[model samples]
Target: MEKNEKYLRAERKVRALKGFYIHLIVFILVNIGLFFIDLIFSHDGMWFYYPLFGWGIGLIAHGISVLGFGRLFDEDWEKKKIEEFMNKD
Candidate 1:
């Protein structure tokens, strides 16, 4: 029961991490393409930064969701660490 829950949580984490990586890669590739297009087509001003900034912000949030946001170090992990330290003594 608990083992199954742990495994499910691990799988969810792996899936989220993989999705974030894929999103990052796509963001990079698509932004590169957009940059080139903007360079060749738009002649008045550099408007590429708009999408770059917006999408970059989204990418940052995605990274935070996967890596930060304290999801990884939730209560379960904290309790495990506490048990480990208590057992060490």
Candidate 2:
């Protein structure tokens, strides 16, 4: 049972990491396309930075959520929280 749980958690972490990578790739590709579009079509002011900045912030948050800042919310922390909740009256 413990091994199965570990496997599941590992799978979840792998999925999250894969998702972050995919998001990163998409952000890069789309931004490159947008840069060229803005460069060719617009001459008044540079507007590509709007979506780039907004999406970049979201990407950073996604990365932080997946990678985590430290061991603050790791599997051990999750197990502790689960036990704490289960033992509550």
TM-scores of all candidate predictions against the true structure: 0.76, 0.83
Lowest summed lDDT across 10 adjacent residues in model 1 is found at 69-78
Please write out the lDDT profile of model 1 over residues 1-89, one tens digit for every residue.
59999999899889999999999999999989989999999999788889999999999998997899858777688999999999999
Which residue runs of candidate 1 sit more than 4 Å off their true CA positions?
70-89
lDDT, candidate 2, residue 62? 89
* Pairs of residues clashing in candidate 2: none
RMSD of each predicted structure: 5.2, 2.4
On residues 22-53, what C-alpha lDDT tens digit does candidate 2 reach at each position? 99999999999999999999999999999999
**Model 2: how far residue 55 lies from native, Å:** 0.5
Clashing pairs in 1: none
lDDT of 2 at 81: 97
